[model samples]
Target: MYETKKWKSKFFIVAFGQAISLLGSHGVQFALIWWLAEKTSSPLMLGISGLVAYLPMTLFSPVAGIAADRLNRKIICIVSDLSMGILAAVYAGLLFFFDLPVWTVFIMLCARGIGNTFQQPAIQSIIPQLVPSDQLVKTNGWMQLMNAGSFFLGPVIGASLYAAFPMSVVLISDIIGAALASAALAVVKVPELEKHQLEQEPIARQLKEGFTVFQADSKLFYLVLGEALCMFFYAPLSSFYPLMTSDYFNLSAMYGSAVELAFALGMMISSLMFSSVLKIKRKIRTSFIGLFGMGISAAVCGLIPPTYWGWFFFAAACVCLGASGNIHSIPLTAYIQETVAPERMGRAFSVLTLISSVTMPVGLLAASPVAEKVGVNVWFFLSGAIMIIITSILIWYSKMKRRHP
Candidate 1:
């Protein structure tokens, strides 16, 4: 049995802080996208903003990972949160005083991405320190629940705030969320790992070490590749889903919120199930299964009739997609924590983030043009098919490796 009392308090505190932060950040993100859409009515602009927001994660993840590995992870988390808060405040000022130009939003997104590059790896690294090995899955489940809750609440709150007050209010809320997260990190005491005595290395050398560790493990390498591919296709769904629901499905913005809420509900339900009852002996296989399910859900969602029933079907699909995807993700995360040396965990996760983020912009960029040339329905169909093919290939490859070995 794991020692619950020793670490549970810290775990809950950190989790609560993250939940609060996510709620605010996600709320602001949705509002920003809606504002852009209302202003420009351009999918291309939204895609570009999404690309800018994520590009930093691709560019800086390796370096961020190295810093997380070499420096104090707790300090990294705190500083990143504070920086994000300051940046959000800047955005609030821009929205309040100046005309909210597209370029300004893009720049702010880039700044936010920089903060994320540091925070993502640091938070993942810190989780292992806070919880026992056996509880990793449960902890991840709770994390997912928080994520789902944020998704569920953020858009609703954002829409309400945008309706009642100005965009500045939403931005101010985001700043507060970041400030609270930083404060939470300050209060918590994260135990540190013994520093590894490596020869003092150049920045490039340290960055290269992250890549080397990832490459040395074939299973992890392929897993990262799979994750990247999934993100490549799925990332655009965020940009497209709103447009699709409003344009294609002829639903209101409320419908978009409904779809998001449905997806989050699915994730929450699955996260609960995983935390309580689900167990997978082989992490890789479980991941493969989850990927397969996600693909199927996407495909089915695409086939749903574009009517009221369509919305219901889409909601169902979101639930399946979110749940199965989370189920797969939790085990993979736990496996990584178990397999990677503690010293290298931050870098390894950063490398994972780097790979995942690199291809996402390409996916988002591709989404609009593809939808323009083909139809939105066709785009959905193609995305589902590609997802299925990729998941199938990974599953086959893993099975073949096992058989041959």
Candidate 2:
């Protein structure tokens, strides 16, 4: 119990630091999107900026993961934060001195994505070191809470800052937050794992090993496939929801705010449930149920007609998505941490990140065209349906294996 308490303390500290950093980053991102939209009035530009920011994580994650496996994970974290901070400062300078063009914003966003390619894998891999195996769910709950909080607070703070000052000043907040995150990491003491010293191995061989692990483990394969599909379909809500609410429903900016807030609230509530109330004998079963529920709620929200009543349903659906997502992610993360050897954690996380990154751009690209051709409502409906179908197939497969075995 004493050891558990100590681990919890460390976990909270790291979670807190990350929460702060994420809050600042999310705020800056939202503020920038709004700024660009107001300045250019072009959805295409916003889509381009989004693409630039996310595509690197998909492309570079494997390399970053290998670097994490071969080096000090803490150092990787520090370097990534510092690099991102520098980029944020540069963005501020551009906004201050020159009329920031679309290309410039895209370039800066790409730089940040490159930095995150390193940061995300290192961070995900390090969580296991900070908590006990049995406490993985609780620790993950806190992490989800931080995630939800960032989404909840970032946009409001960012918009407020942008209103009160110039974009340069607003961007400064991210720099400061990143610096603080680096400092927090510096102070934390984590048990160091031996770096993979197989320097003679080709990068291709190393990457192949990471993929081999996933391929060999049928459970992991299904889990990853489910995760990738969910990300691919679910990501569009972030890009298209504001337009949907404002244009389709003919609601005010307040409606967009409400939608975002509702989503965050759902996440927050679900995190709490996972930590405090929900319990399951089988983690896989719980994950399947959560994913299925999220899909169902999403589909229902899409099908409902636009009205005040529909807004409530949409908010409810958002809550279901958040809760179910947290339930699925916590176990998946813990399983990876436990199953992978310490030295390989970095590479494992990197591969996972790579899969996530690769899928997101595809998802975004798909969302825009689908929204244009069919309508955002249809897109949402189809995406949700896909999630449900995919999850059902995986779950059925898992059940058959269990019965046979």
Candidate 3:
């Protein structure tokens, strides 16, 4: 049994530690992408990099989720962080001595993605164990705030450090961050699954059980499918953010950092509103507003002129995109946490990840050629329009079901 009173303290400690690691992660990610962008200056190369970074996570989520349910969740997190730290240290050491090829970078990213595959589901599932049922939404909001803060600072710091020092220096921070994360996790006593809840079954049957649990809720199932489709458009555009700022706008990495900062700021503001001031009873409807808002904002981002003034407009749209994305994502997450059985939470989240993650890489691969040929902006415009159409149809369908039911 958990000490109810101490839940707040424990949750904050975990959140703080994760924030440190995430900050380092964001900085490293910015450095790597910017370095690659500077070196290749090709959309196709960037798309390929995104593919390598995300593919491992997508492929391994089912297994990872199973481990989270069966194994010691805290140990899984600690091992994952340590593994990533080892990878970072090795990468830093290699980069220190010699100029690593692009393939080497891809290998590093793939490994990191694999580590993340295990860490994410474990971390997400742990929250419900630590916090009370009523506080789940607030806790998730705080987590978002922590994430946004890291994102807000990471790119600017990464850009500045990369400009002054080597990429190796930026990566070293990840090792330190990882060590701290492991230390924090080690001290916390995460609850274990009861023997009855832990089924010693074959992987395929367990995987199918995960999907079946998720499929039990038809409304959430369809809504998740809708989110999956939106991701097909959103993911590629996100990977091309650097090109949109630097290549299309003919700006510097600092400008790219600023755009990212703007997005983070937007997330922070919206998270604060949702957690504190806003009382959203209708989660599904609110998520639709978020989805529809993101589509419109994305379209505006593509349509903006490639001028100094237009960059301001683009950044503004990004703020809305961030805000809307939070609105879209948080409620659904909270819904899952609230409704799903605790024993099955990890597998449930994994199923959600599987549904959402599969589309992203496909979209990246599909968009790479189109973006390379037509330009990054054209795909952004088209994706945004398609999202708008999708959202409209879903809204109508939702209304019709309400009336008919």
Candidate 4:
């Protein structure tokens, strides 16, 4: 319908606005986490909070994907943002009126998660339509940059707002952001998917068709599984990073900021490199390189003790993990965009999100207790070992089959 220049221009407009909204949403997320931590002081409650936020996405993302394919994605995205804004407003109003329990906040977060469920697949499905195939990797890398930028700045802003203002105010800020996002999306012209009779089939059957694409390309299936394994190994390491930084390395709470900053900086650097320098043709091989780098850095971080140079080593590992991770994810995403049939992309991406998460919840549930028993440092080392082992197997298998993310 349009040339690369036109689509690219529209893409930037949408992306820029979405990035602004993302920053606000992330800020509110951290604010709520900090608020819950301050109020509950119960690890059990905090853990439950995490579960409530993520589980809905895992459960309903496929359904959301189905809806995205069936419905107008532009409308879906706008409605998602506006709905979140309304919910945030109402929730904030309730908090202002009376002393709402922690359960209320958790429930609201679950709603936010559901909003994300619809929004994420819709956006992913929309991206390929917005950019030329050759530019997918560059665009994906830029998206990663926006995410990393939000991650780096959101918490700081959220913490500051939380400290200076009330919870209601922080929530209201999220609403403003949501409104801005919706307004931006409201203007973008998204090309519609042409409908087919098969799409009108039963939901269960439609979903089955989605899964059947992987059978058509077993390499894609294997690629998704390999990434799933990476995500699984990453769970314990990510969840317990603060604990390891504080307890294992004798770093202060503030020191965790430096570690996170290092990761963000790495992501930014990788994003820039991907956009310019890294023309990653062997996308699968690039992902493997990243996996190996991540595994080695994580292992080294775990093995190092709290000596004078401990912080330096830990910071370096975090940077490597973050940079390599961006390198890993960009091409895989671009590969999916390039490879999958346009008609089935929504389901394909949703399935990837779904199957790639098979172990993460399990990992999250098990990590705390495992770390307690084995020591947090030990947990990191174990995750790194798992990563390395899995990557090695994948590499050998790929070589044997001459298959490729």
TM match of model 4 to true structure:
0.90
* Local distance difference test, each candidate: 0.80, 0.77, 0.86, 0.76
Best by lDDT: 3
Top TM-score hit: 3
Quote each prediction's TM-score: 0.95, 0.92, 0.97, 0.90
Question: What ordering of candidates by lDDT runs from best to worst?
Answer: 3, 1, 2, 4
What TM-score does prediction 2 earn?
Answer: 0.92
* Poorest lDDT segment (10 consecutive residues) of candidate 1: 372-381
lDDT of 2 at 124: 85
**Model 4 lowest lDDT segment of ten:** 37-46
lDDT of 1 by residue, 144-233 (tens): 888888878988888778777888778987888888888877888888778676427777777777777768877766776777788777
TM-score: which is higher, 1 or 3?
3
Off by over 4 Å in 3: none
- For 1-405, candidate 2 gives per-residue lDDT tens digits of 125557777777778888888888978887777666556544455556668878998788888988887778889888998898899998798788988665677888899999889998888878888777677777777788888998888877886887789989999879988888888888878777654465468888888767777787778777787877787887666666655565556565555656666777878887877677765446656666777877886787679677867776776777677677777777677677768776677787788787777766778787877676666777778888998998999888877986896
lDDT for each residue of candidate 4 in 1-405, tens digit (9 for 90 to 100): 346668877887777778778878877876786566556544445556666776777898789878878888888888999899899999989988988887888799789878888887788878887788989899888888877787677667776787788888898778988898888878888777777886879989878766787777766666666777876767546545655655576665346556766777788889888877779888877877787778877887788777758888888888888898887778878888898777777787778667544455666677656766677777678778888888889877878786433
CA lDDT for candidate 3: 0.86
Q: Which parts of model 4 have CA positions greater than 4 angstroms off?
A: 37-45, 245-254, 306-309, 403-405
Check candidate 3 and list the clashing pairs.
Answer: none
Q: Distance from true position, residue 379, model 1, in Å?
A: 2.0
- Which is better, 2 or 4, measured by TM-score? 2
